[model samples]
Target: MSELITIIASLIALLSALYARWTWSEAQKANKISRLNMLLALKQHYSELMLKEHEKARAWGKDDSYAEACRNSYADYQIKYRETSKELENFHARIVADNI
Candidate 1:
């Protein structure tokens, strides 16, 4: 009867160890999923900000009065503005591609 009791106790210990290991694995997976969701939300927020910037830049480009003022105030303003806008657009495109 003592030998039988010892065997049962050993089996119970083994089962407990396995259950703990499985629970730990599940927790790790849940943490990874939560982290991934947060990263995706952050990326989406950044994308929205970039889009807003792009719209603002385009609006500035469309305003003839603003362009004239810039041109008069700075000789290379138009060139610089166009270049910067292009760079921003390229960066936005890259971000969109990465998300996809």
Candidate 2:
């Protein structure tokens, strides 16, 4: 009877451990997926901003006087886009590294 109880206890422990690990893995996967989605959205936004900035640059290039102002604005936007892009890259790298 003692041996049977011990065997049952061991099985229960093993099942508990497996449940914990499975829950943890699922949470981790969800978090990583969320991050990846956020990164993708940011990338899309960055692309749109770049497209707008390029259009502004092209328009201003056709006019000598407005060139400087347009260039400066585009520069600022470029900096912002770059920072966001860097963050996205970091998120993607982390997800990949964790095999998520």
TM-score leader: 2
Runs with alpha carbons beyond 4 Å of true place in candidate 1 = 57-100
| 37: Cα error in model 2, Å | 2.0
Cα RMSDs, all models: 10.1, 3.6
Shift of residue 23 alpha carbon in model 1, Å: 0.8
> What's the lDDT for all of these models?
0.62, 0.81
Q: Give TM-scores for every candidate, taking all chains together and pairing residue i with residue i.
A: 0.53, 0.62
Indicate the TM-score of model 2. 0.62
Worst 10 residues of 1 by lDDT: 70-79
Clashes within 3 Å, all models in order: 0, 0
- Residues 24-87, candidate 1, lDDT per residue (tens digit)? 9888666655655555555555555555555555668775766555445443444444555565
For candidate 2, write residues 1-100 as lDDT tens digits.
9999999999999999999999999998998898778777877776787777678878666766576667776777678778878888898788789876
lDDT for model 2? 0.81
Candidate 2 stretches with Cα past 4 Å from truth are: 1-14, 56-70
User: How big is the RMSD of model 2?
Assistant: 3.6
